[model samples]
Target: MDFQESKTKENLARSFAAECQEGARYQFMAKMAQQQGYQYMSMLIRTLAHNEMAHAQQFFNKIVELGGNQTQNIEITAGYPFKSGELLDVLKQEAENEHMSAESIYPKFADIARDEGFEDVANLFDMVSKVERTHERTLKKLHENLSCNCLYKCNDEHAFKCDECGTIIMNKCAPKTCPLCKMGQGYYRIDFSIN
Candidate 1:
């Protein structure tokens, strides 16, 4: 089968567009978080946005390298979420979106690529699916923490790091503001390592 005419090629194009859209959406979410006085949360969302962009880059590279699609339009039709609401609700919905991509969307793409004899593209989809799973977990945990008003709280003695000034504080809950940077508690982050 010709690589340029394969379904895998189409999937790659779709994946690239989807990842780009997700990155932009997350940036919008980050801006909202920052405006709402959750600086560290905004930074975290920006990190996710960056990850999505990286995924987009990989997909674009695949289209160029395997499909020679640099000048040609790939002509893909796909649906994307347009969400707005409270920041917490948005995060929760984003988590669900990640779950759909990880468990349903990307896996199906990978299977199709494998059946089409595009093993490398299948592997790429598999790898990105795993990352999306992690993204889902991270977003869900974030939604839970923020909803419970424990974005920086723990039941046991723990450490919190200020996103600014690199200040480390050991406490059950973050201070109202960083002692050094004077930034609000929103600048503090607790390890959510959803791995």
Candidate 2:
């Protein structure tokens, strides 16, 4: 195939990968929210999942329009090391993944766009990178708020278990550390038992 065709394929692959990553993240978030009884969070995650799916479809259409076949697939691998099954952990993971994808994949697509004289495509990639960056910042803020231990001090026997990080907190002594994942204590949630 020609250089343009090759470049288009590469862009499609990158976009597919990014969509897959976002989909996995949203799934995880929804699951965690359900476990934690966070109705809003769960709804938000489901919405995000739909949005990512739409983006993936858009990329697929673009690839087909460019006379390319769907050549890449998505695989949901193991979760991140710092992810403790907590909302904060989920947000952190999402932010980190978006940042990493922007840094690694976007530039390659940008290069390809430049080489193939597809400056508009390159600009689109740049716009995507910027949006991903914004998402990272928002997630970071949410993580900080959830993980903060400044105003909570409870010594109750029932430590609320954070559905996201699975950390057990006692008497507000929620260690800023997740024993399971070695993540900071900010990722822990109260462990509540139905009994």
Candidate 3:
């Protein structure tokens, strides 16, 4: 495949994976909410899962509609990368991934639509892009206030130590700031777990 073809395939794969992951996460949330006696949240999660499934199907249809093969296989990893135990975290990750995918994929689709003389389709993609941008902003707000225990426990004390202040903060704090120097976290080099 050429560069454009490769990029298209990657974007398609990432979008497909994001949709599947969001669907599964919503389903999981629904089940967990039910068990936790949160009936309203459970129903909402179920509804969201339905929406994600529709989105996934729509994306598949669009690929075929645009003269792309429908049988292309995509591999979905096992678990979500973000903190999935918290509802807000789940929503934030979903929205962020959707926005990222929209930013990367929708433009390509729009370009294709324009090349094919489908001005209406291009306009639709533009609208989708705007929606995704809104979603990204909303999720960022949610992520800022939400907190949860680290999904993966790290045993290496050196990993949590801030390079500037040399303070050994916990995993959660390791991503935020150095308690001593107040330097921005994620600045120190530390191996992140791949969920």
**Number of the top-ranking candidate, with lDDT as the measure:** 1
In candidate 3, which residue pairs get closer than 3 Å at backbone N, Cα or C atoms, i.e. clash? none
lDDT of 3 by residue, 1-195 (tens): 232243343444455556667778778867875674444345555776776676667555655665355445554333345566566656666666767656876787677666656565567566666656665664454344333423222444434555555665445335554567776543343333321
TM-score of each: 0.93, 0.60, 0.48
Of 2 and 3, the candidate ahead on TM-score is 2
Candidate 2 scores a C-alpha RMSD against the true structure in Å of 10.7
Candidate with the greatest TM-score versus the true structure: 1
Name model 1 segments beyond 4 Å from true: 69-71, 191-195
Point out the higher-scoring one by lDDT: 1 or 3. 1
Where does candidate 3 stray beyond 4 Å? 1-6, 68-82, 95-195
Q: Residue-wise lDDT of candidate 2 within 19-124, one digit each (tens)?
A: 8668777877888866765543465567767767776776666666665454444233333333445677677777787787568667777777767876666776
Error of 1 at 163 (Å): 1.6
Tell me the spans in candidate 2 whose CA falls farther than 4 Å from its real position: 1-5, 68-85, 149-195
Q: What does the lDDT read for residue 88 in candidate 1?
A: 90
> Local distance difference test, per candidate?
0.89, 0.61, 0.56
